[model samples]
Target: MTGAIGKPTPYIDAVQKVTGQAMYADDYKFPNMVYVSCLRSTESHAKIKSLELKKAEASPGVVAIVTGKDIPVPFGVLSISRDETAMAIEKVRYQGEIVAAVAAETIEAAEAGVKLINVEYEPLTEFFTPQDSLKTCTPDEQIHAHTKDHKNIHKTAELRFNEPEKELETAKHKQTGNFKFAGVTHGFTEPHSAVAMWNGDETLTIISATQVPHYLQKNLSKVLGLPLHKIQVKKPVLGGGFGGKSDPFPHEMIVSFLSKKIKRPVKCTFSREEVFITHHGRHPTEINMSLSCDDGGKITALDADIIIDGGAYGSFGVVTSYYNGVLLQGPYLIDKFGFRTRRTYTNKHQCGAMRGHG
Candidate 1:
């Protein structure tokens, strides 16, 4: 069983996964387990006015009700942008952002609790595209406070070598084009699911369908205020992440927090439609690309300016912003190259890594 670098090799766990013998996160069961349901915001962008949980707390079979205030700390895959909480805090930047969660004896009870919870919101201006973000607005209108001068821009990545503009002007042959790409979501086979339990010794365990268990472990420690040794993140047989499950999800944090508070196992699973709402797929982009060549058709210079929409939270947007320009450095030889990529915040599902990042 020897193979060269380019030769095909069998995946180590292909047999177990294909034969339906693999244990997925949802397959795990614990005694006295409770089901959790999350209440999501319906507004694209809004400030949270007030939340009423009296009805939800009194709902039949509802054991515990949690809100953003319970787990207020933010966590993201990238350290540069940790701006997502287990639930919406003072505001919700996207329509589907979770605002509340309930754990109950049965799934039906959890659903009932979800319907009982009431939320009041004051709608704010929404930025649906990169073009909208380029326009300056008041500080209160900006999606995030970090953006300077009331801008919605999340990141601006630039790289330059030599003088591409000067070379492009001297080149005899040149080609330029405009490109626009709509955002896309990963259509993984199985929806996201997780089961969390609190160990008797004040430790927590999370079994989830995730692509990066180590990342989740580190984030759980940060969000839960617990030591790394006190938390364990296990990735079970995954149906296919396609980079969608790479980030530590809010649902995972919600389940873990609820279980610890109630001293019982808590499980949260997403429906197919809900999975679409939790997208972190390809970024929607507007690009201007120019390539210059000599009379002999030899490559001279290349330049590009790209504007990408990074909705709601910055999942893997910082890396995505760099990859949009940096990945263009290739096997071909070129004397001059330049690129500028601006990733802006939009009021929608966030965009992150996918099959082809660039």
Candidate 2:
């Protein structure tokens, strides 16, 4: 009944969406566009020992093949952590890390080429989820040796707002709850896909199904080792994103690297199974809440203790841990707030930002 920021208006593309006239990234077609297949690492934790590309390179209609070594740069969605890669060259932390990619004249040929790539794996003891990781964690054992902390904890933090301890002393009412949300996929029927072309003049153009084009442009530039200007990322009308397509995807970069190597257009569209395996989704959070209120029902304090199962890598978990506290501070008036969130790394599929990410 009071002030709302802006009156809701009809979506401009409502017609296109309703009538099935929407042209998503997968809908675009180009002459001589080559299909690409990305080979994902199935080992939850293993070192890539070797690869044999002779058969794949010689396959019929196969233009070229690219692997982690083809693109040396390692990058991530956050500027703070640039540890990820288009393909995992040394060790794969997750089951779906891209190990190799193939580009060919036809989709079938590309898929066949992927099979031809020989990837040798050296097995490592696996940890399934955060609980498992913490239980078996040792000073010598490392899920990510790159982390500043010695343990498998990807990131951890404790933050407080105003003064919570004093306010709770006189509060009349107190309540608390334990909440848990399982990992949920964005489930945008149209799966993640991208078409990348290497322009003859030292530039690459990418048409991807993504939410943050500006971010993708920057991250892709980091991974490709190309200047930001050389890479142009265009996001066509999306069937759905729901925060799934916000980050710079490894598959998208795989296509770009393959396109660069082949000097032709390469397109990689994720299969439904691949979509679940390769892409990052919501993190399962276990939250404990506490609240303090006065006799008149005036709220005095709020506190949240959250543990996020940050599968494998630090996606938005770096910030989600903080957001879980910040985002819940308002909506109900509280004088003081206190929060402590810890995000731990696991061996499952990595958790990135998703709709209702917290």
Among these predictions, the greatest lDDT belongs to: 1
**Model 2: per-residue Cα lDDT over 107-188, one tens digit each:** 9999998888888898887777666665545543566886554557777778787878666665668888999978888788
lDDT of each: 0.92, 0.81
TM-score of 1: 0.96
TM-score of each: 0.96, 0.89
Clashing pairs in 2: none
Backbone clashes in candidate 1 total: 0
